[model samples]
Target: MMKHQIARVLVLVSIAGTCLSTASCQKTDPNRKETIPVCGEVYVDGQPAAMLQIQCHPVEGMDTQQPTITQAVTDQEGKFQLATYEAGDGAPVGEYKLTFVWQNFSAVAASYSGPDKLKKRYADPGKSPFPLRVEKGKQVDLGRIELSTK
Candidate 1:
């Protein structure tokens, strides 16, 4: 009958629409799920260093610099976390120069000794320098810093 034909046509159209919708929803690629973290950590000479505490410069000769990334201080186990940016997080993605400066001082020498030379000379911290390259959005695990007494 004419009524039966019309009902069958309507049902077929609905099924087709449903199938198309489902297919479109299922077409998302697995690769699109990649994302970046908002933070991370750093290490120096096998000791966990504070994030953003170690200054990082993106380039040289630009005459510009960035702030230390805020990071948790290393725990007793020497563990830390680094900064992260979400996928498409609009953060600058590239290379950086990680700089660590040890500015040790002699409090007793500074107070008592008029001549700084006679005081015992240890790692000045002012002289201890650590520099490295870091790739953004990549894990930079600095295993150790082998320093020389010389």
Candidate 2:
């Protein structure tokens, strides 16, 4: 009887351990909203614009009080993928105004800083010329956005 009881306790402890491990392994957040994939490219003077910062600002009629602003940095190929909650997870469905800012990289500071390469022309969402609409269950490909230094 003593041996049987010990075995039962061991099994119960193992089951409890498994349950805790499974619950802890899950990274999903209950409050996390659904997101759709968004991708695009940037061009300046008909050339690929690399290392530019792109932001999606929620416009009117959307949740601006606690808005989830999606953002991305252009790769060397000038490609970008908007991420809000996680890397490459995309943004929630809404109407957004796009903003772009290209800052010079400072090796001394070990970060990208300094004045805007675009001269803050695309820094304000209110004055942003690019208006984007993200639909439910639909992927948004903005194609190529052309800019000019002139």
Candidate 3:
């Protein structure tokens, strides 16, 4: 009699614990932004432009509780992976204006500042002609973006 009641109580507690754990695990914040992967390469005068920064800004009506600006750094081969919400995660779905900036570490260190090797027009987001869109659950591959040294 007493043993049966104790067993029933234990079973009920276990069921309740499982339900609570499942609910907590599935919980998601409504304000959390969703993102999709974006990647590309940068080129200068028909060659890969390495060690540069690439940024994407929402064109319009894309802002949320989370930021829409996605940024990436180019590798040795001029490859970049955009990250908005997290590292290498991706960017929110929207139209974006793209911009670039060369690291110029050697020039900065040598104090031989003259002008950007890849043209100054590529730096400003407002003036940049590169416009892109990110779609949900889709990976966007921006082919070689060419820049002129002259």
Give the top-scoring candidate (lDDT): 2
lDDT (0-100) at residue 47 of candidate 3? 82
Taking the tens digit of each residue's C-alpha lDDT, what string does model 1 give over 20-99? 99999988555332223223343444444421123334444222343323222233343433342332222233444444
Question: Which ranges of candidate 1 are over 4 A from the true structure?
Answer: 1-52, 60-72, 84-92, 101-137, 146-150
TM-score of 1: 0.31
Off by over 4 Å in 2: 1-5, 24-27, 61-66, 107-110
Q: Model 2, clash count?
A: 0
Query: RMSD in angstroms, candidate 1?
Result: 13.0
TM-score of each candidate structure, all chains considered together: 0.31, 0.87, 0.70
- Give candidate 2's TM-score: 0.87
**Candidate 3 or 1, higher lDDT:** 3
How high is the CA lDDT of each candidate model? 0.40, 0.89, 0.80
Candidate 3 colliding pairs: none
- Cα lDDT tens digits for candidate 2, 59-93: 87457455576899898889999999988888888
